[model samples]
Each structure stands twice: as structure tokens, then as C-alpha cells.
Target chain A: MSNFTIPVGPLHVALEEPMYFRIDVHGETVNNVTITAGHVHRGVEYLITKRNVFQNVVLTERICSLCSNSHPQAYSMAIEQIAGIRIPARAEYLRAIADEIKRVASHLFNVGVLAHLVGFESLFMHVMEVRERMQDVKESIFGNRMDIGANTIGGVRYDIDPERIGYLREQLAALVPEVDEIIEIYRTDSSILRRTRGIGVLSYDDAIDCGVVGPVARAAGIEYDVRVKAPYAAYDRLDVPVHVLKDGDVWSRAMIRLMEARTAIDLIHQCLDGLPDGPTVAMDERPAIPPGEAIAKCEAPRGELIYYVRMTDSPKPERVKWRVPSFLNWDALGIMLRQAKVSDIAIIVNSIDPCISCTER
Target chain B: MLDTTTIPLAVLLFPGGLFALAFGLALKGLDRRVAARLQGRVGPPLAQPFFDLVKLARKRTMVPDIAAEPVFLGTPLIGAVSMLLAAALVPIPGVYAPNPLLGDLLVLLYLLAVPAVVLMIAGSASGSPFGAIGFSREMALMLAYEGPLVLVVAAVALRVGSFSLSDIVAYQQTHGAFLFDPVMWPALLAFLAFYPANLGIVPFDIPEAETEVLEGPLLEYSGPALGLFKMMSALKAVVVLGLGVALFLPLAPDGPAGLAVHLAKLVVLMLVGVTLLRVSMGRMRIDQAFAFFLKWPLALSVLSLAIVALA
Candidate 1:
């Protein structure tokens, strides 16, 4: 009978990232939600400016673990644009392969947490187990499980031999069928539908107005994928299908991730098939930068990751700024959680895949 | 078999206290392991729940400055003890029958509801905002499920023409179990629906929903107090499942085989009805779950009552 404000997070189990929400509720219905960030802020932008171009690749990649490859890849692309360096075709395909693999793993991780938040523990575990295969692929191919460190100044640092390519092919072929089965379960399971179908609806207009990106934007029926729209890296070479849904609810967000994971699997296959036989990295040393201000954007697993670089003749850059997709996706949480039940708050927050480490960094 | 001294022994030792606690914890462990296997992973050991209780016992119980100390500290004890008594009241067909002086089906119903009431009290006493939300949710869930439960009990009592559990079991023994009777099927189905909600498992565990409320009332509890709550829940599981066995299908042979049969039935029920169901479904919001309980189970119980009255 009492209407009170419940403060969730900063240390709550539901939150994977460190953020706080002052949720005002009248009984079961959440009346208002106020979000606060900065818990995981690492001051990486200022730190990145202190480092040289080669070091900045390592620094930017440390920004967020889930989209670690995207940061370095985007930062490298911006420097490539400034330096006018053309990466070899083989390196471009290799970069795309790394990005797509991360995308599948990242999307699976988000969807798996969604299942956890909804209290379907078995589904959460199953989704995570499926994601483990992608993690293995990243480890086997890129030499690391989390921060793969694939991208350098001119191109990708990691190359696939025919055996590794065969390994990657075998992994993807096995993963696709399991991913399809999970997608089918999410699509038709009555309990999942009842919990998520209309839980946190973000209309197409709201999604566009909020400038939501990645799976969150696509879920709102907005055909705005940075891969399809901007065509960065090897995405331009391959036809990356933009997966969209009309509902804009938690269900749509989850479905979008599963669909994108499928697309990512196929994209990886295409990248491997068309992988050119050339040098993986253009230069053995860090390329010399005589750079003006340049901006580069890449579609991260979460959304659009943009890096802005400004450099003079010196090795250390004047300034380096980056905007992560979670920044855009986080604002939409206020809209999504408004008027939602207390039970739906966790799932809705998770549906946005709001990466606090990415946003605060 | 119906002595006053045996009543306390039954309540404190064999059927209730130690026995119920051990069985309940093991059942929970089995549920977790089976669920993990179903999800394709290596689960915790079957002794995991027991280990968790031991771990909880070693921690500190912190009471918030705003909390009512006695009520907050006392509820878990009360909840656990209530289940201990409730466990003895559940007759295991031929092996066990509670003393007539101790309680019967109706008294057992009131005892079964004590844990929810204790949870509500604990939530309210903690004076935390999450606790308040949990308080409201636990109250709502109790209100929603109590009607169908009472109605189901009424139908069974009316069919047997006695308020005592022993009479109901005896009637079923003489004239075959109600589980096989076409007319009592609705009541049986309603009882099936009621136990999961009563046990506070998924789809109906909206009150202590871990993600939303952070285990609600038990959030502020730690150390042995939290362990007591865990023990309370474990015993409550046995009591509720045992009640379902007693009310619907108490047809085991007399002696040690009867006790084995009863325990096996409890394990099967816990695995199939609780573990599998929890794994498959998502938690329902309070309103949705409330509406569900009031709609189908209420209707089914009412129908069973009407059918029993006519036939």
C-alpha cells in the first residue's frame, strides 16, 4: 500500500554494469526512473591523448571488453583516413571476421542475460553455453578470449591460415544450427512471449529521435545499421543484411540480437570464403601520421562506435575522443522503463544492452 | 499411535525437523543439478544447497538501523518452526499419521500459510524500500493463491466428509484414491496448480523475485538468520509437496516400504513439477500471476466443489 522509491544497482545482481536507478513506484508500477552513471569511468579519452597512435590502439581497445575490437578498429580507421593509408584486401577481410565474431558473441551475451533477468535460468545457461563456442572461436582465431587485439594502424594483426580457416568454418557451421534452435524457442515460447512481447515498447519514432543504434535501433523497425548504411571495413564488400523488427519491445530487442547473430555467422563465413591471400598488416612498423582532424565510425556489437582523432606532427596526439553506442542506447532506458512494472525493469535495462563501462569510459 | 508424547517427537525429530530439512535441501540440490543438465552444463554437486546453508551460517546478520530488530530477526525462526510443525501434520499414507490432538487438514492449511505471512512481516520489519515492494508483492500473491487453495481444501474435505487428514486418507484408502476419481480430478488439478505458487518457485515467485527485489525480505538478513530462512523454505517445500501427496494420493503400503514410496513420490513431484516447470517458464508479474490464479484454479476448485456437492 505504500508508494516508495527503490534504489536499484551500483551493486545489484541484476546489473552487469555499475549504474544506479532511483525507481519511484506506487505498489507494482514504476512511476518514474532516474539514472546515474560514472561509477566505472576510467578517463580513457584523456589517457588516450597522452599515448602515441600505436599505443592508442591498445588504449582504445581497453575501453570496453564486449566491443574491444570495435574501438581499435574504428580508431585505426580514423587514423587511416587521416594518413590516407590503404589497407590490403586480406587485412580488411580479417578485420571484418574479427568484428563479426565479436558481434555474435556480444549479442549472445546480452540475450543470455535477458533470459537470466526474466528468471528462466535454464534458458540463460543454454544461451551462455552457445555463446561459449563463439568465445572459443575468438580465442582460437584471435589469440584472446575478450580483447582480441586484432586491429593495428594499417590493418588487422591476426591472419588465418587454411587450417585456422577450416577450424573457423567448422565452428560456424556447428553454431548456426544451435543458434537457429534458440531463435525458434524465443520466437514461440509462451512464457518468453508473455514476459517480453509488450513489456518495454520503444516506438520507431522514439528510437530514431533518441538516435538509438545497433540491435536497439533495429528492434524498433528502424533500418539504420552502421554496417549497411556507412559500409565500413569489409561490410561494403559483403552484403550485411540489416535485421529489423516492428514491435520495439523487449521481445523485439531479443529477437533482433538472435537474427543479427545469425547474420554475423553468415558474414564470418563470407569473409573467410573471400579472404584474400596477401599481407595481413600493411606496415611492420607503426605508420607515420601527419594528421588533421578525422572521424571514423564502425558498427560495434552494441551499436555505432565512433572515434575522433586530432594529431599534429608529433607522435603524441593533441586530442582523442570516442563515443560508444551504449551512450546513445542508455538515454532510451528512461523511455523504456517509464511506467514499466518493477519486475520488468531489469529485463528492459538489459534489453538496451547498456554498457556502463563503454558509456562511462 | 496417537499419544501426546509422540506428537512432539513427530514434530521435532522424524517427520518434521531434521527429516524435512534434509529432504528439502537435497531436493533443491537435485532441482539445480537437473536444471543445469537440462541447460547442457555441469551443475553444482547434490550437496550444494547444504553447503550454501553452512556458508550462510558463518556470516553476520546485519539489521538495518531503521529496522525493527526483534521482528526482523524473529521472522525466519518463526517461519522455520511453522514449517517444522506443518511437516509432521502431513501424513505419509501408511507409514505416518499425525496425532489427532496435534492438528488436522484445516490446521495444516493455516500452518502452510505461515511462511508467506512471515515473509511479509520480515519485509515490513526491515524498513527497506525493496522490502516494502516485496511486502506488497508477497501480500498480493498470498491473497491471490489463498482462495483457490481454500476452495481445493474445501472440496476434498466435503468429498471425504471430515476435516481431519487421517479421515481423508482413510476414505481414499477404502474407496480408492481421489486421484483416480473422475469427479475429484478438478480438485486434484487445482491442488497441482496451488503447490508451485505455495512453494514460491518460478512463474509465481514474484514476491522474492531476485532480479527485481533482490530476494526482498531476506536481502538485509545474513549469517544464521538467513540460513534459518533457507531452512524454512526447504522445510516448506517438503510440507507443501507432502500435503499434495497426502490430500490426493496417500495409497502406500504399510511400513518401511511406505516411507520409501512416499519419499520417492516427493522427489518425483519436486523434479517434474517444480524443477522442470521453473526451468521452462519465465516469472510472471504480480498482476498477471494474480489474475491467473484467480481465473483457472479458482474456477476449477469451484467446479470440483459443485460436482462433489451434486454427486
Candidate 2:
């Protein structure tokens, strides 16, 4: 077995989105990885500039389905910053609630796919079934599952009532036990540990060098979370615990996500309990736009999501650009995949939870 | 006595050709249904594998431009035909016994190795990178597991002092099944590990891992050519499980009752061993699986042989 190159995907089963990797291997061990992305490039950045400031919120939400909530929320925050509109206390809590709800769903979905990539179908199915409870909560509260149109320019679009609050609490209570059980299984399951632990090791140095964020960064012992580091919405008021692990392996990334999902549920509960009674919007009508630019960052489920918005006299913005977490994390694959077995390629790629749609946008 | 007249009937009708194929397919269907139930989903119909075979047979058999067309097309035929013949060799215990002229245990061992060989040939001949990887992994895995399997068979043969499977069954019948014997437990455990690796399920399915290599050797196969590979595996399920029964636990009242008991054993084995096991574990890397087989099964088989010979 001399050196040979194998293509992983633009359409592989392991990847949720399109991205190709031309891997050079000596026998079964990978010597190098060459990634070719942009299959999912929708010219979204260009499209963002065309849409009005208000319209861009909808367009940005469509950038990535998993982090859909964070996009509009971050974009709106930047818009609010430029307009100098301080949202009511109740809207801040509402925004945080929506953010946490999306975080729970996103993290569980990533870990569930990890189980799937590991070939643990039963665990994968179980995790997905558990995550369905959160999906139901999203649909019930926000009127949709994936893209939960939860953000507006001034505040949140949706608000939770007493009945919805009760429903969410009940779901969370049920979800806690189920998620705890899954965490235990992932912790102790020899099959999972064998395949993941120490397999795709990215050292703390490599992680810092790659500038990976979200669970990928935290798993490598980076004590960074935008919610805590630079709090937005009601995150500063809520107690956000950042879970970090030193292993930086595939298992560590999955474990970090699972732990954060547990924390997100708690954060959601805190927001619901501290609900302030006030107007959901900052103003009675749409405020007039002024010429200005602003930058806003929020902790998305994956990691830090930053949005830059510049407005002119026109309703449409001069430019709207976003730096999604996947952009920084994609660089870490080269280090993780070095000296990796061909079998671990999918698992390692999945560990980053790479958003091709967001990265290529 | 060698009976020439009954050979074709035995091979084609009662226990080998149509019967084995149907029974094997049913086992596959049951495995899928049980696995789905375990995973909390309503799976495909019990006849889904059969429907897939029918659907595949209706599709076109594609040959890649770089592939050795003849060898690529020929390997599945060889694999399917070999399993069909192997199925005839497995005795159904008190219901049907293979004639002495047809061949015995050693011959069955050689035939059992055919599918892996055919896969290796098919893989390389396809001229695909994934197929090449599959070929190498399959070869490594076969090398790792085959040694244990032969030792396991040798232990059983030494215990019974015969290579004839019918004689092994008869000995187990009077002396009680070897499955319950302490000395044979290591061999039984070794066989248990061997079958899953041989059957190519999870934890040992690294070679054809759909996520990793897109079914590897079978990635290039489609239509009736793919249908033949499916049939080969289906028939193989019967032959391998049937072999396990014949060697260790061939205890049943003679006649139709014995046939019923034999079918029952195979279903249980397929559901418990194959279905439950595949759903519960992730696939092991090729090196990990190879190392596992060499370390555990090989050592256990040797221990079983030593214990059985001394006892």
C-alpha cells in the first residue's frame, strides 16, 4: 500500500453539507488532508447587501439552519447598536430564552450525529428522540422547528406566555433525565470511547493555533464562551457555565456539547423565571435608519457568531457580513487528521461540527 | 453409502438452494425488524431485503470504465454460487444429513473462506480507491480471524475425533451438547466473535463501512450484480449459523420437530448475536478489529484446543 489520495465528499454520507477533502494516505493512515469547500456557496454575503436592513434579518437566518436563531439575533443586535435603541428588560430575557432553546437543540443534534458517525445507531436514535422534545418546544413557542423566527430589529419576535412557560418547563424536566442518561452512556460506553478517545487528538497548542471556537475550542481546554466573555441579550444576567475538557479528542468535543446542552436547559429556565413584564418591542413603530456601522457578537450553539452591519441613507444596508464559527474551526482539521486512520476521518470532521453553508456563505 | 440420486434434490430443494435462500432472507428480515424495534423506529417490512433484491435485479449492472469488467462481473457469481454449495454441506441435524460423497468439515472451511476471497478480487478489479482499501482491510481481517476459526474447528474435531459434521452432531447428541461443556466454552466464545466478523456487522464492518468507504467493494456494484452479492450474504447467514448449530448444539427430536428446532435456533442467533450486537456498538478501525481478533479469539481458540485435548 503506497501513498494514494481518496476523496471524502461533496456528497458523502457522513457530512450533512457539501465539502470535499482530497486526502493522501499511506496504507490506511492519512498523511495529509486537502479540503476543497464552496459547494454550498450561495453568495449569501452579496445577497445580504441587496436586502434592506429589516429584510436582511430573514436572509441571515437562512444562512445556516442549526444556528438560524443566532444569525438574526446577532444581526438585529448590531442594527440596534447602530440605531442606539436599548430594548426593554423583558425583550432581553425573551432573546436569551430563544438563544438558549436553539442552543439546546443544536448541541444535541451535533452529539447525536457523533453517535451516528461512531456507528452507535441505538444511541444515535435515542439522542435524536430526546432532542425531539426541544424541537417540539421550538414549534410550540416560535411556530417553527428549525428556523424559529425569534428575533426582530428591536427585540424578539416571539414571546412566551404562562401556558407556554409551563409546557417548556415540563419538557425540560423530562429532557434533563434523558440527557443525563445519554451522557452517562457516552461516558462509559467502551465502543464509543475506543473509537473516539485519543483518536483525533488536537493538542491545546494546536487548538489555539487553529483558533477553533465553540465545543471544538472548549474541548481543547480554551476557557472561552462569548456568552460569558462578552455577554449579550440577558446572558450577562444569567449564570452561564462553560464546560471545558483537556483531551481535545472527538469524544471530548461531543462530551462538551452534551454538557452545554444540559447547561442551556438551565439557562432557559433562568430566563423564564426572570421574565420581566414590559413591551416586547423597543418602539411603537419601525425607527428611522441613520447612516452608521456596528458590530455585534453572540454565543451561537457552535461558538462565537459575529455580525457586521453598515447602513447608508437607503433602507437596504451598505454591507452586511458575518463571521460564522465554522470559518475558524475548519482550519483545525489539518491538525486533527494528521496521522489519523482513514476510519476516523468522518468522526474527526464531524467533531468540528463544520457548517459548510455558514462557512461557504 | 454415497447416494448420487439424492444429491441434486438435497442441494436444490429441501435444505440448500431455495429453502436456504428463503430461510436466510427471512433471518435477514427478522434481524432488521428486531434492530429497528430496538432503535425505537418502525423499520422496513420483513420482506424488504427480498424487495431490494427484486428491485436490484431489475436495475442495470454497471461496469466502471477503469474496472476489469469480466473479473468485476464474475466475482459476485462465484461468491453466490459458493455459498449455495456451502449451504448444502451443513447438516440440519435429525432432519437432513449431507451424503459422505459431497465433502465434509475441511471442505466447508475452505468454502467458508470463498466470499472474502471473492470480495478481495472484486474490490481490486473495480479499480476504485475505496475498493482497494476494502480489499486490504478484508485481507487483514481474514488473516486475523481465520487462524482462530480453524483452531476452533480443530478443537471440536479433536473432542469428537472426527471431521465429519454429522458425527460431531451425533457425538454431541449422546454426550450432551458441547455448548454446555466448560471445556468447549472458550471455543464457543471464539466462534461467537468469529461469526460477527465473518458476517461483516458493526465493530467488525470497517472494510465496507458505508460512512467511511461507501460500502467499499460493493460501492461499484449495482443491479443484478449487486443482487448476487446480497444473495451471497443472505445464503451465508444460513451456512454460518447452520454450521455453528451443527458443531455445538445439534440436540433435537428427529423428524419435523428437529427442523422446527433448528430454524428456531438460527432465528435466535440472528436476532441476538447479529441484530442486537450491530445496533449497540460503533465500528472499530481496521487495525483495532484485527488486533482484537488476534488477541482475544485466537488466544481463546488455542486455550479451548489445549483444554479439549487434555480433558
Best by DockQ: 2
Worst 10 residues of 1 chain A by lDDT: A282-291
What are the clash counts of all predictions, listed in order? Answer: 0, 0
Query: Candidate 2 vs. truth: CA RMSD?
Result: 1.2
> How close to the true structure is residue A253 of candidate 2, measured as C-alpha lDDT?
94
Chain B of candidate 2 achieves a TM-score of 0.98
lDDT of 1 by residue, B180-225 (tens): 9999999989888888998899989888899989999788888999
Instruction: Note the residue pairs that clash in candidate 1.
Output: none
lDDT of 1 by residue, A1-361 (tens): 6678889888899999889999999888889999998898889878877889898889888988999999999999999999999899999998998999999999999998988888888888889999999999988988899999999999888888899989999999999999999999999988788899998999999998899988899899988888888888788889788888999999999999999999999999898878879898777787789959899999998888888889998888888888888889889998999889889999999999988888888
Mind giving the per-residue lDDT tens digits that candidate 2 earns over A1-361? 8778899998999888999999999999999899998798789889888878888889989999999999999999999999999998999999999888898889899898988888888988999999999999999999999999989999878888899899989999999999899899989999889989997898899988988899999999999999999999998899999999999999999999999999988998899888999899999899987999999999888899998989999988998888989999899899899999998999999999998888898
Kindly list the per-residue Cα lDDT of model 2 for residues B43-70, writing each as its tens digit.
9899998999999999999999999999
- Candidate 1 TM-score to native: 0.98
Candidate 2, which segments miss by more than 4 Å at Cα? B1-5
Q: Mark the regions of model 1 whose C-alpha exceeds 4 Å error after superposition.
A: B1-5
